[model samples]
Target: ILLPLIFLEKHLKVEVESKSETKGNRNTSFGVKEGHYLVGNQGIYKVCKFLGEGSFGKVAKCTKLGSPGFCAIKIMKSDRAGLREMETMKRIKHLDPDKNHLVKMYECFSFQNMTCIVYEILEESLYNFFQKYEHHIHLCHIRVMAQQLLTALEAINSMGLIHCDIKMDNIMFIRQNCINVKLIDFGLALETKELTTVSRVQVTPFRAPEVILGLYPLDKSVDMWALGVVLASSYFGKYPFSYHTEYDTIRAMVQIFGVPEPEVLEKAEHTRGFFVLDYEDDDLCWRLQTPEEHEQITFSLTFSSGCWRSILKEELHQVKPSCDPREKPAPQENLEKTEAPHTDSDQAKMPIGVKKRKKVFSVKKDILLIGNLGNYKVSDVLGEGSFGKVFKCHKEETEDIYAIKILKYVSDAKKEVEVMELIRDLDPDKNNLIKFYEYFTHRNVNCVVYEMLHQRLYDYMHKPTHLCNIRSVAEQMFQALSALKSIGVVHGDIKLDNILFADKNSLRMKLIDFGLARKAKELVKGTKIQVTPFRAPEVILGLPLDESIDMWALGMVLACLAMVQIFGLPEEDLLTAGEFAGNFFTSDDGGNDPVFLDLLKRMLEVNPQKRIPPSQALAHDFITMRHLSGESAAEYFATAKTIMGSPSSSSSSNSSRTTNGNPQTPESKKLILWR
Candidate 1:
């Protein structure tokens, strides 16, 4: 019901008046007759064919009566329309013109009872293209589509506006010299600075969890979550989240992030409309819940990234709005600087000279040869990422094999090279961190030379393992977290794929991909704005962040290792793992499996404050007391076997230690495994 009568005319003062004139040239600046038609004017427009129709009006392809150029005219019922939508669009006209991936508005008119607005036409929408190709879209094509969509989103958001509708259909492709995307259908656009009721205003499936949970006063971030969904859809050909009904979808969302801890709930209640209720009947009941039950709990994905701009801000005031019938053109200087200063300092080092890179497999440049720094002959491409391709190379000076990260020009080599250099120089020492040697730009490729590693953790996690030493796994993960925090940088993006095993023993791990890493200084407090699922609840709910996030990720890694030991499944397989890893700690349901479900709860506390800090994690009874009593990885495995010696000889050796940790109720411990 965001109609014009709702608020516009009631508050606005229209000063235009009508004039006594001929039928063809009736002059009423702010009024219209019941049956007047602007098309009847010979100097105005010559309507040719109808194009389409929607809730607003009907569209027709037309030609200016006096001009040779063509445009699409949308005819609306003036008698039934309000001026809010028109005014809103008018304000954003120059921000993103229809000519360049945006539908440009020409002249708007309401002569008789009919209102007509002219616009430039485009070929087709991305929705149609995506539907035709589905998952068949090549990776390169997907990246291009993502980039175009990002550009459109960035432009719109910079204007302090929200495209409440960001589905594929709203994006169009211009079929000219090259394919480019355009954003259209401003039917649901709104200035981000204004506040609105929290009923609901987004396409489901693509909507963010915050929107679904009645969280409003939302910024441009809601759009980033949708962008992630669209990107996921490109690869899978369907919404990452889908259900039979909206209720089910909402319920699923709640299951993922439904209840905050008591303290968080208390703090969140400070907000005007936040809900305050504990999930359990009583705090004690929640406390009684076992770790296994907690591990099985799953929440919807959360996303937090400062990637786009808000246009209503002073930064983009320069982009001139389409000339208003009543207002004069704006100052020229304002139009030139059409965006706010980069708020994301991560990109601050990314100089403007570094052109937006293209999507390609290998660097389109020569090998970087440095005798004193490092002599690495770039060989075959090992893997590719958003910035560049990682290649295996042999260092001629040291005759040592290494992995050289070569940033393609299209991948924005300057930024990638800069981040690499920072990681090499500033990153603290940790066996879990990839060693950096040197960084340089060679012609078109930005090269990052680093110590070579053998296999990705993703490859090793799924391999067969008879018995895993939980203690060893915990130590390795803890060391990584410790090292990362020491450097004042959060890994930002941490998952098995980004981890590399040092050798065949699989005991050592090194982290990679600092492109998404964030400094401790820049993060918004309580917001765990990093990777989702493995994401901490604080980050999920837009809370400020801390080292606790690393602990949460480490918790997921431990769960991954434990899952491998007990269930013989990769960490991701647990995403759909039913209640077998349920949030209950009954002896029969779980062997009180310390490593399986119980230990997971202690680590994956939804409340960042409640989550076991890395220092405390090292002392968790289950990890430190039971597993690591001066034992080696092999020795511990032997002890685990001896403890499970015979079925009848069950004196409950492991069971006796179950009560040792003042085990919190199974209900209190809910774990969202990393899958």
Candidate 2:
């Protein structure tokens, strides 16, 4: 989709183009000062500092004079100016401007004789973030940023407005160290019908020439070009064909990508003076010719960046594409994402001679020091929970994978720290526990790092047949339990999802999710600990608590897998709670394996005090004793019951006990674990 530079200009051309500002308001001085109150009497906005200067007027940082809330106000020098932007923003109002992905415009009013529009304040630009990495951004980081840019552009285009200028400077994150970006600086925005009136009001490096050439009528594709160039810059810090003059810019384009097709040349405006048809080499192609040769024929390419010659596109491509941010990313294979960026000294040697940009603003790769995290670069999100989300992060020094958990502000960090400390004391080398690597705070959020794992047991639950190596999995969980018990920590929430695979093929798993975990001594009176179905009878009945609760959930998890394996189905169909789970043990034929059935019964016994504990489970015949046929040990399923009965029964009855026959129905199933 990039058009070839068919006709190269031998020299720069002077033509009418969009100027940054008009001379009419050059001398008008709006006597506004920082800390001065605006006209709004109830909640006056006092100016903080000037943010930027634009064609309309100045954009200022302002605070609600009496409150801590911050907002931005864009001032129009005269009521007549910025009408286009005002109308465009009003149209966007109905599209839910408050969306975190879009910059929200609150309202407009007159302040000190200037038309002022107030909006939510956002941090520095994506351009600033790009600079922080010194243009050595990772493809993974660019993909995240680019995908969001595409989504935002889709939203803008859907509203039937062209954000005429789509560049890194206009895209920004809501938080200094976050990826949720929003589009800003809509000064040149226009509706489809009004584009002809403002043909050139866009940034030069990101310019789309088709519409600017004054040849074809432009459409949304023009903005797409700008988006492409912006993404292109995240790699090299400059557009591909960038040059000091419009003429040489085309030369740069021609150098990287050969001459364009003949059709592009014929339809292109200003072509008559710059290119000629070449038929001598057995093909008709457009070739760039010098002026003396151009004296016989013509065409031209143009853009407005004034200093772009030395950094050629090929020079950028020379940087390894593996890490280059412009290598059109492959779509994520699975929804499981866990990316983050930073550098940790303990993990790797620091890059040398990096000079700090002075009084720098918010940039993604700013040397964020979070406790033991040291220096690491963040990748993408793994998943999110009620508290916050987890990202795939790497130690800059070691280049190893780790997970970073970012949660909402902690009113008390003491509990989490205590919990982490106790675990380190119990399992310092993290043989069983998902190792806690580091913990730190960023502004209002708590960022903690942990050992990243392969995949979740819940994520692979459909592969009940794969879990046939029951002996291996059971041992692993017990190992994790031994560590938890040593620290007196109760992983009250244990289910398939909370268990992560060490090597999915090997069926090795580990216990996680200490969010609901508490030290046995710190358990609050009347505290509700376990999840549904997996909840031990004692926990549900408000009886005294202990580590026995986990044994019950573990029994249920293995039992569910047993049902799936025995029934030869991909997943379990029966999931009843409390008394309703009687069907589990009472099934007429639960795959008819009495030995495995008895072990589960003892594990799920009604009395927590009477239930099998972890140490005993380790010695139980099912875990320490028996070998699996590699087939599921059976218990409870309509299919299993039918298989053991007569053929007439299998044909006459519907085997599926899943909710209304839909296995994925929420009422019929609960994700044993999600994070």
Candidate 3:
């Protein structure tokens, strides 16, 4: 009788479980489990698993009874808040999801007193995707994602809605293998008209200035700002602003974008929270509050009291408000030159035959025709240097983009063109050299056209570089130098600004800016060459100069990548014969790989004849990673991660060492010479 009763209870439990799977369970608790059925108004779905959980509720992967594929069911704890999100979805339901790059909401229903919204399942969020992939997104892919996100924003804004929580996590890819993405998570979304000063929205790092400052009557621009942050984070593989606290974030914003306009600050209710009124030369202006003052007003300890304060103070000193040209007083020479020049009475007093020359005027046009080959329309200025300016231009006929370097003098341009002709036989892509297309004279300025590439290494590498990446860059640059050496040409300038990404996706770099390049035979002793920070010892000492100076500059570049310092040879006595071997490498000796140090020493040899050539440096153990203890090498590179001190501290330390007039140690010598 006991066995029969036990069997009967077991049979009843199995029957109840089967019933729950088919008919759906009426569990009101937040602990919904797998295999539980959710009975929606239009369909029934079986909970497969919980994908993620948040303060609001859990998102579960589910399969509809008759559906072909999986869907994500957002089971919200608060039915009222869930209903609000559903209403926002309904507002955008008329727009085509794929066309607008928005997440497709299939249906919404109440399941056991909880509001559940079913959305088409996506591969993953960008935040999760970036975790698995460690490199920064390519610019082309970033542009595609930006365009899709902008489309999504346009659609949402058309419906009078703002996705207050636009972030990496809120963006999802339609498929893992493709670039298609859609915007999701409208939980914090609100109508533009509904925004208030007290409405708390947005993740702190991506929060807009207007929102952070408690500016009332917000619009869709906040979402635009968040999208900009998202795109920046994607491109850089990290957030552009500080994520620690609101104060840090705002301070970074001020440092990068400058202080908000006076009119903008005047309207902000929280203006005084982050800024204070200050007088600069008797002119009133808004200045960023010191961290101490901010801490006193907010009663929040954001940073540690001791070391962080000094660091923050140094950073604050570097934060100068951007200059406004309209506010500047004219120079005395300019004021006198423009003082009612050549009035009619003064012109009449001139010599008899001297007539006022009709003021000849020249108009600069945006469109530049290149001798009937094509019309290049100039866009933004890519950069400006001692030579002249590089303008980003595209051919009007083919819309093909190119960087046109317009030289300041025709003679300088002729020399560059001559150097380019020497390498014309070699494949620019194969040789890792900038590809020159054509050179011509336009408006008395010599313009040399080349294939437009990505960013310069100087601006692109802001964070500490990885050893693997540094090695790759070193190898490519060596190959470039070898090619130039093969032709007896010396790259006079090989600084960070001269190297650019030929193909950023693959990290393929190319050497650029050959304005100072010349044949090896043309190098003259006592002639100043190379950037000051990268100038070789021989060049500074007025000794013999040759292609080996380029090797020295490349060595400096590698040291910069590894140790984050650029030791310039500014003083002649610093490189005097026996004094070059002081305690410079001793301070941070433990953090660097011995093999790398050996390579740097070889390349940076004070004797130009003994400097390692590009061929030999290419074969160095540091570049090849040959015969190295794998574990020790790994440890050294890992330790190298900490060697890059904050830029401000490094600059300050370098300045202090250089300004003192004592007999310089090798470290101080390096510091003084590089800058």
Candidate 4:
């Protein structure tokens, strides 16, 4: 049953401020305080203190008079909304709240022209818990939460009702230190048949695509979609999508899931509001409207100083719906090819083979044979690294595509194959490591097959990426490194080119190119490892290396993505026990985030013995975003813009800063295999 305790998304600190202001006006309004009694049909509850408050009103932690235990009474501002929630709660009253993982409701009553619903007291909301813990929820904990939430959803769905708002703030634990959670806040709940296009529901980040498109007669699938988002946010420790605007959310959804089906779009009442019909390859498809297009259409009326400015019909007609079923437009001729845009010297320095690769193999005619005479059709070159050229290929009988890395030398190829074999037992997707399929010799060259992934991180981060996305990348890479370290392996080459996104939408990164990988026991002193810019200080100092070197390189990768610089090493005399402490540590201008700078300092420690490990790096405040609240994260993004967008802080400058004395051009930042 629905509970009255609806804690709004505002920070807890803000709630305290509001409480103070409300206390000053407590006598003027119908505000209830400690000592006030809420009389319900079941019993009388003594108001203890406020649990939370919103526009709906305050929920008080109350003790039942003459009873031993405590309870919660939701005092809603509007009786109409309160009655609606009570009715929804009554519909689910038959189901066992404990079994279904729903918050137990006691009774509803009116007091001082307000509606108050009594409920069994629950612990803190998941939102408050996250604020206190500030770390990624373990998969095991997530699994337990997912199961209980799903059970709650199943129970609600069985009654043919939708919770409408399934977010972290709506879910609360049964008690402290317990994984069991109950679904709360069914204030927006409605029956399936009552759904409509105009119904405003759901928090922005958790809103479904169909709902955003204004689909009528919506089903329970929207609730399921929100639950998926909630789970994703819990695991990733951030919202899965950028929720700054409906346009931004839709754009991100398109990038990840592609455009919605045409039939679905056609059924949507407000499809034209966010998408435009365009012809591509002689077929019409709906494309997301640019932010400018959306703003022009939706913000046509400008109100300034009590005056209104209406948009002209001509301006509105510019983007008139072309895909309307009633409209039959004239066919247009195929567009002509245009000349390639000229690239400046700086633009030319971007990683090569990032754009569409040239088709080097005649896939339709000759078949490329690998070990066991497996007939594969080579399509195009995926990329070229220090090890060899990787080709995109399709097996004869399967539609699945695979990346075939052809090593120039069999010796290097065999070494990489050995490393791949060592990591074969670990789940590639779970560990964020490239999935190795098979390896073989073809015409004296070694070939390794892997689950094909998208472009390299180098190609993806042409501009400064969002800090949220960077955090996702960092977390995944740390998982990959942790997996390798568990098996006593080191991914010696952890450069941008060696890490690829598992998918385009989610920023699921995987570490690639283990050609330079070595066992922890095999590490030797004075051996050069990693590419130039990502090389650890210990590597340059002729000190012994281990898996910690990968952590240092990963830190460098994160620094590059954030467009920040690692301060130069101090004089040898200043280095004590290989740790950067005292003045040396504080002198580094490692951007604004102190947590990030702290993690960076640990990873970039000059002494290999003192450097942070992969496991610890995973828990670093920078990676966990522990102290960063939603508001602070937004602030961090604002600060990140100035750092990433500055011309002086570009990749070129970063390369120069990381170099030893000699500043290298962007083109010269390729992987260096120093023997």
Candidate 4 — what's its lDDT?
0.61
TM-score of 1: 0.35
**TM-scores of the candidates in the order shown:** 0.35, 0.41, 0.46, 0.46
Alpha-carbon deviation at 43 in model 4, angstroms: 2.5
lDDT of every model, 2 decimals: 0.48, 0.53, 0.63, 0.61
Candidate 3's TM-score reads 0.46
With candidate 3 superimposed using the best TM-score fit, by how many Å does residue 675's alpha carbon deviate from the native?
Answer: 25
> Model 2, residue 265: displacement in angstroms?
2.4
Query: Residues 1-675, candidate 4, lDDT per residue (tens digit)?
Result: 000112122321222111134543434445688898877777788898988876556789999878898888888754567788888888888899877889998888877787888888987887776676555454435545655676788788889888888778888877653456799988778888886543466777677766777776666666766776676556545554556566666766565456777777788777998899999999989988877787898873321110000100001111122222123121110012110101000112222222333433222224474555365777787776545677888887775788888775667788889999999999999888899988887666677888899867777544434343554565677678777878899888777777887775446678988877889899898776666676667777777667677766665676655442223344434543345343222221123234533543453232223445434554555444345456435544333222222122123332112132211222222111110
Residue runs of model 1 more than 4 Å from their true location after superposition: 1-43, 66-69, 79-82, 96-100, 131-136, 196-198, 251-675
Which 10 consecutive positions of candidate 3 have the poorest summed lDDT? 338-347
Model 2's alpha-carbon lDDT is: 0.53
Give the Å error, residue 35, model 3.
Answer: 1.0
Model 3 Cα lDDT, one tens digit per residue, 278-391: 999999999999989999999886742111111111211111111232322222222222111000001111112223333221213476646346778887788766557788
**lDDT for 86 (candidate 4):** 82
Mind giving the per-residue lDDT tens digits that candidate 1 earns over 1-675? 001111211211111111122433323322323222256333477667666645455566777757786676667657433254566567668674632246777666665666666677765665565443332232223434444455566677667777666666666655422334566766666677653543355576556544544444455555555555555444334443443333334333334334554444344322213232335554531221122332233232323111111110112111222112123221122123222110000112221223445656544334545534766776767886556678888777776888877765634455444555556654434436778777776665567777788776555543322122333444555566565556676666666566676765335567776766666676776543445535556665655566566555544544554343333334434533556643311111122133322333433233434444323433444333244333233343333333222212224233111122221112212332221
